[model samples]
Target: MNTRVVEIRNPATGAVTGTCQGPTPAGSCPYAGRDGVVPCAGRLVGPAEGDPRCWPVWVPPGCRQCRITFNDQAVACLRAAERYRDQWDAGLHRERERVRALAARKDPRFRGMSDRQLQVTALWRWRLSGPAQGLRHAEQKQRDWGRMYLALAEQQRAATPPVVVGGAA
Candidate 1:
């Protein structure tokens, strides 16, 4: 879940920036604990000491050079969460519109049919007469459609209101 990545910079001016995920070597620097220890000569100077933005002269042993900062990872996660939220909202809106449209218009051919039943019927009809590659293809589609239609019909019957008989004298 850590989204940190190492950044590469221009050794001359430090103005140029790039990124890399290479692993840092596990060895001590010869200049460790020496007063002469400093940022790489090519690295930029005059920046605040211990500034996270400033690239280090050398990374410590057993460390990764390509790690991203905690702040950077949090920002990235926020952006991604916002994007997913937007997508989910858009999909929900579209689905709502679809259901509304389906409810608003009633196809005479599919009167009393549920949305899925109507869709199956419509698709079957379209495929039955539309540019099918062969008669067998059309037949197969028709059979599938028939099975679906029958299943829907059975469900509808099961859910139908029972008719009442006349009262006896």
Candidate 2:
């Protein structure tokens, strides 16, 4: 479906900042037009619950039918975004678990390394066996995960209770 949208751009960089889709040519609603009744003012709304994607929609106090229609359209977009997000999260979780398994399989030679280090090392090991460029994307993913892993590890370490090896000091 061709949804006409106005692209919001950054003034300095001239990059697309965001977009707003509307049902009318004027790019807004709740206005007088050839259709006589343009319904309540429409605008793009989102970063809504369960999704960060926006959708062209109208709010209440106008035609009940129009309001329901707009809301249903918005809900459809949000649901689609939610599904994609769920898949992406699941994939990341699986990848993290796989990395953890790989770390366990390593021998004592890697015993002192942190889990994040082991993950990056594992990626590098794979890179060594293939075309360098082919593993570039995977390497980048590993680096991003490494930073996240380290931050989580730091938080966990800080939250842990100190051990009392013998007796009270």
Candidate 3:
């Protein structure tokens, strides 16, 4: 079966950056151009000039107006968020499994326990803390990083020339 593909390019260097599957030509897919199939036979070309899709994925380094950039500080914050979120999810999953296993045992102590009781037991044993605490910590770190990014963006915007009200007083 024919598959559609979208070729992304870096406008500055005219180099292909990446390609993603586009809609098939059957008119069922949105990304499919006027052509019926998702044009994947050959290398999909980048969008023509003025096409909205030609925009860069990330602002270049040293660009002041960009709210988000691939700077080291921003990248490190993102990595930390991912790591913390993953750890929290894994802990929750392990707690759930432990509760399930405990419930399945025919031991008298667990035999008459309700679902809540089993869950509480698993949580205590796993030392799983409240989600609110974790979320708050992550949010604080994100806010700190966001402030730095915003400051840079504001500085860039201020450096740009302002528009004249009516062609020079």
Candidate 4:
């Protein structure tokens, strides 16, 4: 989120007399603000003071960098979803559990419950409610968008090698 307005300077004085009225962030876009913008020069948070970000940027996309951030976040979300899916799948062996829990139902603790109720007790309760379904949909969309961003960046980078002028990248 470290951002600055693209600067428009005087030709002779080299002084920042005015700011660009164009896009707020001169991103990795080659034509944004006609500044041949690249990624930010400053290191984003999390690394040491000197290192550039190795991970993608994680923010909403108004700027290209923001897209990268969201892409990274999307990938992260997919990984997390996979882990959760694994955990949820662990509870699905219900028939095996019912056979096993049948013996325990004879104990005094099962005094109030019938065999059916005892068998129905879930070891790993997994339910995809409406909100959970919506989240899954959103996550899939984000992951797809993230992949698209990466593909686009790779294509553009191959087609055009960036040139550095006198200003910041």
Candidate 5:
């Protein structure tokens, strides 16, 4: 999306903590986005009541459509400055490390790219490219399947003899 979203996770377990963890209480991230927080990936735990991922024990946390889209001005800010890390002062070495780590979390492919490489070739563009590429692949696959189904239907029709009632008497 055009904005950044932080999936709030349990610090101890790394499992998504969900939006319900927040205030009106004494403790919460001071940086809650203007857009708000995403709900925990797990809420209702079954197909009869809600989601299938919550079932069969060993329940894996999967994304649901009901995510709270917290506005990501902070992430956008970091993304703007990240590609220029190679030129940042030596004092920013720790910041550079932090930013690279964050980028990798977004996509593992980012790990191979140096800051200069990111800037020169526009890593953000590449990051955006991945999802579009997947969409293109899906569209191509669907088209192939549709045509195959059509051909099969046509062949079946051709093989069937026409039903003639009392017309030739």
Candidate 6:
């Protein structure tokens, strides 16, 4: 396919910023047009969901009909979930260590601390449960995405038949 060049201009002042050549010229770095192509008015330019740069491309009518593009939002969500899971796991580990340390203390006074101290110590031991639960929830969501990915892959495979390499036996 021939790559078409499009001129990107500043909307406010109408000054040309750069030129891009592609089917859908979006998110490309701005460069001065050497071919002297005029900029088209009302061309769409913006990052799709998760992209950082403002891609200069137009979305065809009905976004649902467009091919599946790598969504940054979905990736960001997954990363956030992973961070939450990691944070929860760390908290759980720290809580376990604290419990162990408290259990190993030799001082009798420390062992027979006041009710408030005992409650505070027990609170840390119990606090880990919340993070563990949060991690489970995050992991479940990750698994759900994995299942969805697999299902989509299976559907795609089913839609496309394998080509036979040799004559039928």
The lDDT per prediction is 0.39, 0.42, 0.49, 0.40, 0.37, 0.46
Query: How many clashing pairs per prediction, in order?
Result: 5, 0, 6, 2, 2, 4
* Residue 69 lDDT (model 3): 29
TM-score list, all predictions: 0.30, 0.30, 0.37, 0.32, 0.25, 0.38
Tens digits of per-residue lDDT, candidate 6, 1-169, equal: 1244445444344344554452333422233134422233233322223132323333222222111222323454567667777777677667655655665675463475665675567556655576667676887687566556545534433433222234232
**For residue 152, what is the lDDT in candidate 5?**
44
Alpha carbon lDDT of residue 151, candidate 5? 53
Highest lDDT, which number? 3
Q: Judge candidate 6 at residue 138 and give its lDDT.
A: 82
- Candidate 6, run of 10 with poorest lDDT: 61-70
Q: Could you tell me how far off, in angstroms, the CA of residue 164 lies in candidate 1 after the best superposition?
A: 92
lDDT for each residue of candidate 3 in 2-114, tens digit (9 for 90 to 100): 34334544434435656654333332334444543332222223223323332223323332221212233455676676777677667766876866786787766678888
Question: Ranking by lDDT, best first?
Answer: 3, 6, 2, 4, 1, 5
Q: Once all C-alphas are superposed, what RMSD does model 3 give against the true structure?
A: 13.8
**What lDDT, from 0 to 1, does candidate 1 have?**
0.39
In model 6, the runs with Cα more than 4 Å from the true position are 1-63, 66-84, 106-128, 161-169
Q: What TM-score number comes out for model 3?
A: 0.37
Worst 10 residues of 5 by lDDT: 50-59
lDDT tens digits by residue: candidate 2, 1-169: 1254444333333334465443443324433355544333232222223122222222323322222133334344445545544554455555556666755787565666797786676555544543443344444554455555445434433433333334243
Error of 3 at 165 (Å): 14
- lDDT against true structure, model 3: 0.49
lDDT of 6 at 23: 30
Per-residue lDDT, model 5, residue 14, is 37
